[model samples]
Target chain A: MAYVKINKDRCKGCGLCIQNCKLALLVIVEDELNVLGYHPVGFVDGEGECKGCKFCAETCPDCAIEVYK
Target chain B: MTTEAKDKPKKVYGRPESLKDVGFHFCPGCNHGNVHKMVAEAIDEFGVREKTIGVAGVGCGVFLYNYIDIDVLEAPHGRACAEATGVSRVHPDHVVFTYQGDGDLAAIGIAETIHAANRGEHITVLFVNNTVYGMTGGQMAPTTLLGQKTTTSPYGREFMGEGYPIKMAEMLATLEGTAFVARVACNTPKNIMAAKRAIKKAFKMQIDKMGFTFVEILSACPTNWGMDAVTANKRVEEEMIPYFPLGILKERTTADYL
Candidate 1:
């Protein structure tokens, strides 16, 4: 199993990570707003489902995602 | 205690050391942030942060100094190349580079860029070509494609009125003094990786005392393009790449200089 941490305040809610994740394990929390007043992305299954591919981290333009294996 | 300890995963990927901890001012999904990371990664890999000097031009990329943890100088609009030329000449041992936008490099600063490259100044130029003048509210730029609309050209760019989009990398490649020139994009993972390599190579070229090196990154301007970040990235892959083909337009050898 792998884990991903997102710097919520730094996220812009662009969803690039969501689109890039091949596992479809990421989602944007539309109900919650970050300090920047935008919805930030989160993992659907937390650490359980992530495969540590780092596709989300690689595609995050804001450098908001940190993945660990 | 054992359960808690087992839950933590080792840190694998994070921000580069050469970049500062401050949040970027660029809009969400903007390519500047990614490019900045690539530049910082190159600096970190080469272990040249202390001896690196960055020259920033006026535009969205003007705040590059705020993100990059290195000595940086702010140059007047379209004068980054000129300023970098001076800095590289004065501090020959230090690595000097300029960060510029399409309008700053290809339009107003074209003369400085051409002359600097023509003179074979040992410096690196990171040029971002987003097709429009993003900082000043999406005005048409020299790289703006025909039929692409902008605030200044709301009715779509016309060939007769606006002329053709400038092919900067191709044009610079023909110059005798340029040692390396390549055009890359930041739209996809593969392309972004390629861009990082090109950026690193450009810096390496400067460290090797090769002539002027240039890397033009085709970036996305979602706000200006009136699209979401994903769509803007798609546009770069679909529209921009076709117009500005990717690859090394030129690479000079010792024989050419001799």
Candidate 2:
């Protein structure tokens, strides 16, 4: 059972987490331009390859990201 | 879908979910950021973000609610302890902590801090002592040592003109109600690790329903110190350490705990 989990609803677009990720694993998914408006960033790919560093999860201005090793 | 990507959010350890989406108002090299990060880390490690109430001081960190994700209560320039007393009483089960600077805690609020620690209030105080008043321009503070120059004491602080710096941790250790009293600096990676340990223990003491626990962190204020960020860090090692020797002043473990 991993302890980290990212709450997608609360994710903000700040990339501080991306800066801190040493393993080069996190990429931001910008708003895809839905019918209503722009949306917050989401994990682009490599969800399973997370080293569980929690760097992005920790530095995220929003508690939108989670991690469990 | 590849780990080879250049941009990746590292697995940030010790991140908690209770913090909301807000940055901080501290300076670029201020130690408040480190303290805030450590508090959040401890909250995450202990799983107490939901039940932790952070009381912010009225110094440079007056707007600390911006960074920390928990429920932060802002206190007047020197009234964090008084406010924490009320908050802790209201929410006994919650972990209450206060983040304050030397001027806010050791100077203007010294009386409040002493009384609160003396009263054995079940709260943790994260005290950052940069040895000078950081906000409202640098000035001679109660923790400013002899010979150290400040805006108010450009010719070096005269013992006759300015009283000696207050050894807050030593003073508070005599109160008897204080459960943990440790001093750690943030001058290097080793000190950073030590600071983390002190922070973790302070949080744990509060969890065990212990009395007052105070961690004095020797921090740097490059802007106020009239030096660059790097110099400020080295000053903590060369100058500050000689005066305020770092170590666990008082610990209550088992035999000591009893």
Candidate 3:
């Protein structure tokens, strides 16, 4: 199983992580605005089946995402 | 969080210790943040945080000192290489590097950068090429694509009025003093990994007293490009990569020198 943490305050909601998430596990939480006034990315573990590829983390420009496996 | 769970789950990715606990001021999805993280990771991996001196150039990257926790000297517009030269000369044992934007390195500071590289100064240079002058509100830069439109070139860059984009990597590779030169991007996961490798090698070459090292990062200026972060990233992969062609342009080994 894998887990990911998205620092809400630091997220710029650029959606780069979501675009790179191969599993389509990341989504922009439009309903929730971050401290920066942009919608931040939310991670859906999807039955805890993350591949732990770290693609989302690596592609994040804001360094908002942290991944653990 | 329990200690057991913390120990059980291996952290795959997180902020490097070399990076300060502060959010970047770059626009959403700006490539500078990714590049900064890669640099910090390189510094951490090499354990050179204390010995590293970062020379920040004018432009958006001027605030590099704020992000990376290290001794940083803010150089005047386009003088990062010149200042880095002095820093490296003073402390030959320290790791000296300069972070510069396209406008700073390719435009105003071109002479300083070229001269430093020509002299084979033992320093590393991190050049971020986003095509336009991002900090100055998206002006036409020397590296701007011929047809690209910017605040300065509203009618689109015409070949007659503006020359073709300068290929800094190829230009620097022709210099005899340079030990390594490579072009990388931060648009995708695979590309980011490649960028990290290039940056690490650049620093390593400097540490080994090889000569001047350069890593040209084809970054994205989403706000200046007037595109969303994702679209701007696509532009880097689809447009910029075609012109910049990523890879190592030059590498000098001891065997070649001897």
Candidate 4:
């Protein structure tokens, strides 16, 4: 099984991960603001298993995503 | 998979040891952060973090010292190559590199850059080409594409006045001094991986004492490009890649004379 962690403060909310994730498991949490005042990426739980491909983590400019398998 | 194995996840990807724990000061969706991460990863992989010295050029990447936890020297605008030449000569055994932006490498420092490479300075150079002077509110750079609008090129970059976008990788590859020369981009996951590989190879070449090495990374400038992160990345694929062309332009296993 694979999962990912996002550091909210580190996230600049560029949405690169959201766009690049093959499983489409990440989304920008629009309702709340992170410490940096940008919409942080949130993992949609149980929707799909993260393949551990690390596409999202690699695509993240802010190094906010940490993938675990 | 076993339940215990599933429960306790092994970290597959995270921050590189060579990078500082602090968050980046770059704007949202800027490519500098990604490129910085790659460089740190390369340094960590080589186990040269302690001996590696970075010379930073003026531009967005001027704060390279803050992100990468390595000894760094700040060079004057477009003088990074010259500074790196001196540092590499002084510390012959240490791993030395210069991180420069397009404006610093292809514009103001063009003469210095060429001369250093021509002299076969034993150093590595990381050229971040975003095609615009990002830090100064998006002024036209030597690598700025034709028909691309910037603060200075309001109407667009015309061939008559601006000539053409400079191709640093191909240009530098022509010199006999360069051991390795490549152009890579961070627009997509695959490209990002390739960029990292190229950067690592460039470092390896320098470690092998081949000659001057260069890697030109095509990065996106979302804020300066007046586009969202995703769109700017798309522009890198659509516009930049076509003109710049990716892959290793030159690689030498042994010195030219040998």
CA lDDT, candidate 2, residue B13: 52
TM-score of each: 0.96, 0.75, 0.97, 0.97
Q: List the residue pairs that clash in candidate 1.
A: none
The TM-score obtained for chain B of candidate 2 when compared with the true chain B:
0.91
In CAPRI terms, model 4 is classed as high
Candidate 1 TM-score, C-alpha based: 0.96
Model 2 gets an lDDT of: 0.75
Q: How close is candidate 3 to the true structure, as a TM-score?
A: 0.97
Candidate 4 colliding pairs, count: 0
Q: Per-residue alpha-carbon lDDT of model 2 for B79-157, expressed as tens digits?
A: 9999999999999999999999988998889999999998888899989899888987989889997898889999989
Each prediction's interface RMSD? 0.9, 7.5, 0.7, 0.6
What DockQ does candidate 2 score? Answer: 0.09
Better-scoring candidate (TM-score), 1 or 2: 1
List ranges where model 2 is wrong by over 4 Å: A1-69, B1-22, B254-258
Q: Residue B122 CA error for candidate 4 (Å)?
A: 0.9
- List where candidate 1 sits over 4 angstroms from the true fold: B1-8, B255-258
Give the distance in Å from residue B141's predicted Cα in candidate 4 to where it truly belongs.
0.5
Tens digit of per-residue lDDT, candidate 1, span A1-69: 688889999999998888888888888998999999999897787448788877788778888889888
Off by over 4 Å in 4: B1-7
lDDT of 1 by residue, B77-127 (tens): 899999999999999999999999999999999999999999999999999
Model 1 gets an lDDT of 0.92
